[model samples]
Target: MSKDNFLKGAAILSIAGFLVKILGAVYRIPLANMIGDTGIGYYQTAYPIYTLMFALSTAGIPVAIAKLVSEKNSIGDYRGAQRVFRISFIGLLIGGVLTSSFVFFGAKFIVGKLENTNAYYALIALAPALLFTPIMSAFRGYFQGRQDMTPTAISQVIEQIARVGIGLALVAVLLNLDKGLPMAAGGASFGASAGGFFGSLVIIYIYMKRRKKIRKQIRRSEKFEKEDTSKIIRNILIIAIPITIGASVVPLFGAIDVAIVMRRLQDIGYTQKEASGLYGQLTGMAQTLINFPQVFSVAIGASLVPAISTAFARKNFSEIKKTATSGIRVTLLIGLPAAMGLFILAEPIIKLLYFSNPLEVQESAGSILKVLSFSVIFLTLVQSLTAILQGMGKAFIPVRNLIIGALAKVVIVYVLTGIPGIGVKGAAISTIIAYVIASFLNLRAVRKYAKIRFNLMDIFLKPVLSVAIMSIVVAITYNIFEGFIGLKLATVVSIGFGGISYLFALLLTSTITSKDFELLPGGTKLSNKLKKIGLLRR
Candidate 1:
């Protein structure tokens, strides 16, 4: 891939990613208020199971499809690419059905087996999402393979809008049903499934409209070949199965944590209701706040994968190293300050976002947020590193690292939570330790396979200093405006101010340059524009 082509792909992916993330946060905010922390607890309990199903059905296929299809198309193997797509669709359809079955019929058993039964209905409600998300993913992969993000972007925003509107409506109606909080929580889950169903339909419609012409073009092309359909089916399954298991380890570990913690808490004398409610506060309230800023890194990491895969296919090692390093650096740059800000401001933020609905959840939720804030920086680092290594075709390395981390987390959680004084705090500490270990392991894999060197002076010293300077400015401004402004709105304003200040400080300090940003995969034009507009003062 040429620099220009890579940039174009990155730009499109980043914009779509940002839109999707924004929608994710927007939907969550109102949903959190509607359901309260207890409802959120039930809602969150079902999430890991749903994520596991999503991973099972789609997992690594879209990525593999994106990589394989892009390579074949770039090398003039349109027939092979089309065959892969057809095979992917068939395989995903079967996977989706099986996953949905597990959720639909097994939800009660799964929930009952856990220490909590409050989330059983919510798990059942999310079953249809397991049915459709894989199919939606296949279409997304198809577009990504072609390096066209319009369909994906449009469908993503549309999906989120559907999710938020439908979810809010359901929650509101359920809240009024007098069926109580668990029912309201299940309503949110139902909304998610409804959103997925419609989102898949829309994407499928958009894809069919565009696909007919592509199929006709391929048929007319001299490059087209008549291949055995059976062979294509076998090849796709071979690629997707291992990728599914490998991709799902994180969510699987999460599900395990949910089950284990609930059981353990009950054994230690807490009621199921109390345990599940506490678990909900940890996942829904605390983790949600910390995760909001992480959307930036998640977007960057996700886009980096296909782009790196494409670069690797073209034997563009220079671009590969550059893109991978730029991705990690950017993740750290955005993630670290956000982590610090969250840790310092967790109380106010949680108070603002979750306090009104639950009433009694504010203090505990704030404490959980503080603990979780420490985890996001490491989580973002690990996430980005894994994406880079995986994109470089070093998938097993990340899998191994994740296993090591998961084991470490389990040990930590058992040891800490066993103590009389430490309860939910133990869980949060375990998560932090796990991600830190995972991040280091991922860093090692990147250094080993990608031959990327960490430059301490530039990557750590410069960005940290830039972010620190920005933090001081944010603290001052926040202190001044906090009295008049609510914590939620204050957080937004403070973060916006800090981000702008950090970029300016970086420019003035020569920590980053127009040339540096310009050399990034999809950043040349924007960098030049920034320089011209005096955004990069140095």
Candidate 2:
């Protein structure tokens, strides 16, 4: 694929990821309003466990499949690619079934470890998704490996639509039935399973539609050497296991939080209800908002793996360097502004999005969000660099780095959160510190493997400058407007102004060049338009 084609694929996934996150926000804000913090606690309690399991089951396989297939296809080993997919599919199916069975049967045992006994039903409700999502992920990985992101992007939107619509509807129905918070949350959890079911159906239909072409290609590849099944499975595991471990780090920390945070809060003398409420605010509210900007990073990371893998397979060092650098630069360009914006506008954003909550709850969430805002830059870096490492076939490096980070997080959480005044905000602080550690380690690994020289001026300094200018403008605009206009309207206006100001600063400083624009999806057209209007140089 052309460079532009790679970017276009990333763009499609990024846009879809953003839309999925928006739908998630819509689903979550309303659910938080309806169920309140304790219910959110119950719901969130089930999710981390589910995510950890899902990560083990599906996370690495798609990436491993994508990388393996891309490498095979790069060398014209079509038979090898098809064999990889077939073996991977069967393995994932068996693994998914096993994990789902464990989660379903061990629901009570799992919740017993955590403070939230009410989460048992939610755990059971989430079990079926574990079975379905891995199958969907296998298809997604196969297509992504082929450098076709359309199927994965379409499946994502379909999944999120199902999740939001069905989850909310179930919550409403359960509420009307006069079910308590735990049962209502359980109903919402069931919607997650429903969404996975629908998502699998969508991917299955797409696969069926394309089966004829796939079979034709496989038949044509019969002349190529065929690998043994055992070898293929071993290769898949070799690639998948490290990626799975790396991807599981964040969710593993989340699972740790589910176990530690509430119990610690109760130990600090808070009532069980109060402890759950605080945990709910930390995970359900603050973390939800924090995840929005990460959609872009996740998209870039996903796209980077296959793109870099192809280049690596071809032994194209320049392409690998260019792809990795561009990915990191784009991550900073998006992440810096997002972190700054969230830090500056935390309260206003919380009030705007979660207005249904009481004022004090909104205020508390806002404080937690402000502390969490610092994580955006580090998290984005970790993600982008991890992808680069994985693409370079150094998959185990990120796993090691993340383990160190997770250990740091555990210590920090134990010490800081144990204090009476710190409480939930300490968790946010520990998260930032953990990502900072992981990002640095990943950066060192990338520098060593990719041999990329630092270009601080272009990558880091310029974006930071532009973001600083934008933050100042936003703060001033908001301060002036807040005195006369309502908070919401002022927030909207200031955010608009800030975005425009940031763009202008980036252009005037040449922090972002026309060449940069040309690398993005539809960027060539945008560059041409800007040049025609005398906004961008020739």
Candidate 3:
């Protein structure tokens, strides 16, 4: 894909990701309030296993397939590309079944090891999604590799819809029936299974409908080279394994948190319920908000994989530079404001979302969120640069950096959480530091390999200035509106003003240029209109 098409693909995925995250926030906030932190603690404890499994089963191989398929398409080897998909799909299928079975059957043992036996049912409920998730991911990788993000995007949104609806329904029903927290959490967990099943069906149908067209392209290919399945598997694994390990680092930290944080909190003299509540506040509430911006990072990172891969395969150095730069720019443009916004409005935002909870719970969660907000920029940087490196066939560099960061997190959380009153807040601090180290290392890696010097004025200064301007408006807007309107409405309106002002600042300072706009779908026309309206420069 060309640079413009790359942006368009990112746009499609970002929109879908945005929807998914919103739904996720919708799901988690209600679930947290409904179950309270202790119930959410059980859910969150069980969740890390699903996330880690997800990273293992779905993350790496699909990216590997996308890169490989993009490479194959560059050389007009359509047959080899399809073979890569098939082989990878079958392997993922077997792995998913085995992995999900392990989780389902081993739910008690797994939750016991994590020290949250309350999550046993939740673990069992989520295990089935592992089977379906890999299937959905296989098709998603196939489509993404071919540079068609539509199917992946559409499927994700549809799946999230199902997940939210069913998850909420099950949780509500289970809770209403006076079933135990474990069962309620399990009901919520099963929503993922339902969503995955539906999502798999959607993507599979899309593939079937497009199979004829795919074959038509295959037959018209300038070259058809059939590779041995063994070789294709090797190529896919070579690319996938490191990526999977790297992707699992963050989720692995979840397991780490489950293992370390609860024990540390209890050792520091908090009651079991209090510790669970604090854990829930940290993971279920703070982490849920942090994940909102991560969706965009993930969307951009996904697009970058194929963009850089296709460009690298064709030896198009300039395209690589352009794509990498855009990734960085977009990362900054979005990341800066997201992190800043969260920092500025942490308490209000949390209170607005979790108003059903006691004031102390809301306050505690907001404080944790404030600390976690800065991690957004660092995590986005790590994600963006990691994608660049992975696209350049240096996937392991990121995995190494992230692992190093994860280790540091373990030491930091252990020490910090051991302190009286530090507890889960310390866990939040550990997360930020881990991302900072990982992102710094990633940036260094990108510099050493790609030699793409980021222009400070374009990428850093512009975003910083835009966010500085935005921060002023947001702080003022929230403060001014809070007294006049109610708290939630004020928070919402301030957020609305923040978005408007941030865009205005971008346009006003020309931080987002006509060239940048041209990279987006219909961006040229939008640019022309902006120029006509005196909001854009030549």
Candidate 4:
């Protein structure tokens, strides 16, 4: 695929990602109110286990298959590519089934074993989504590797829509049926399984439709070469397994934290209920809020994997370096200002969105949000760098970094949670500290081991400047809107204005140049489309 194709893919995926994230946040705000922090805690508490297993089963394989398939196809090796796809899909299908069973049937034991019992039923609801998520992801990787963003992007939106729509409806219905808040929240979270089922079906339809098109292309051409199916499977697994393991560590740390930190909190002085509420705030509220900006980072990072892998496979070191630098730069460009905005506006944001809920621990939610905000920059950087290293095929380095971070987190949480004043703040501190360690380790490894170096100035300065401008604009807009609009509406409007103004300022200042725009997925096509639609200045 050409650079233009990359840009087009990025643009579509980025927009889809933005929509999904926005819808996700909007859905969560009410859902948080519906479930309260305690319910959210229960919901999130079970999620890490689900997330890790999901990652182990399918995370690395899809990208590996996509990279391998794309590379093989580029070299006109259709037989090898076809074999790789089939094997990876079957492996994921099996893994998905086992995970779903383990999560669903074992929910009672898992919840009973947990320090917090409030989250047990939520785990039950979430199990099916765990089963189907990998299957959907596999198809996404297949299409993405083929350099088609339409299906992948569309499916993400459809999944979120299904999730938000079904989740809200179900939660309301369950609440009315006199289910407790936590149980209702669990019901909401469980809707992900339904969404996953539907989303996977949508992608399957796309794949079936495209499969015929590809077959026709193959029949008309004689350029394709076949390979042994077993060899292809082995090669795909070799590349995919390490990546899957590495990709899962950060989330695994999070899941382990729910078990470890919640238990520690109870051991120190808190009641089971209080501890559950606190854990919920940290994971469900603060972490979820922090995740909003991460959507951009993740979407960009996901696109970068294939982009960098393609470049590296062809030995275009400079292009690989450029993509790496751009990916990190773009992450910070979006993340820093978001972190700052959250830090400054944490209380209002949290209160405005979640305060109406009757959850027991709402008063202290602001502190939770603030503590988590500090980790966003580090988390975003770590995420982007992890993807870059993986793309360079130095996937083990990220795993090592995560191991170090996880070890640090365990030690820090143990000491800090026992202290007189810290309590759940210890977990937040551990997360930030771990992310710092992981981010630096990842960057260093990429430089030392991969012989990859990003331009420091390009990565840091332009993005920082862009964020500064955005922050200033946001602050001004928030103040201007405060008197006219109610608190929540004012907050929302100010944020909307801030985002638009920031992008505008970035373009005006040339922080993100025309070339940068052109290099983005569908930059030229989007620009032209915008111009045609009169959204861009002539």
TM-score of each: 0.87, 0.88, 0.86, 0.82
Best by TM-score: 2
Residues 79-158, candidate 2: write the lDDT tens digits: 78988988899988999899999999999988887877888888999999999998999999999999999999999999
Give the distance in Å from residue 492's predicted Cα in candidate 4 to where it truly belongs: 4.9
User: Cα RMSD to native, each candidate?
Assistant: 3.6, 3.4, 3.9, 4.8
State the lDDT of candidate 3 residue by residue for 1-538, as single tens digits.
7989987887798789788888987689888878887888888888887998888777889888899989988888887788888898999999899889999899898777666778888889998899999999999999999999999999999899999999989999999999977788888889999999999999999999999999987887766656788888888888888767877887898988988988888888887778878999999998888888777677778768887898888878888877888788888888899999999999999998887888999999999999889988988888999999989999888889989999999999999999886778899899889989998998888877776777889888988999999999999999999999978999999999999999999988888877666435577899899999999975
Per-residue lDDT over 455-500 for candidate 4, one digit per residue giving the tens place of the 0 to 100 score: 6566777677777777787778778888898767878887887788
Full-model lDDT, candidate 1: 0.78
Candidate 4, after superposition: displacement of residue 55 in Å? Answer: 0.6
lDDT (Cα, 0-100) at 311 in candidate 4: 88
Model 3: per-residue Cα lDDT at residue 7: 75
For candidate 4, what is the TM-score? 0.82
* Winner of 3 and 4 under lDDT: 3
Pairs in clash, predicted candidate 2: none
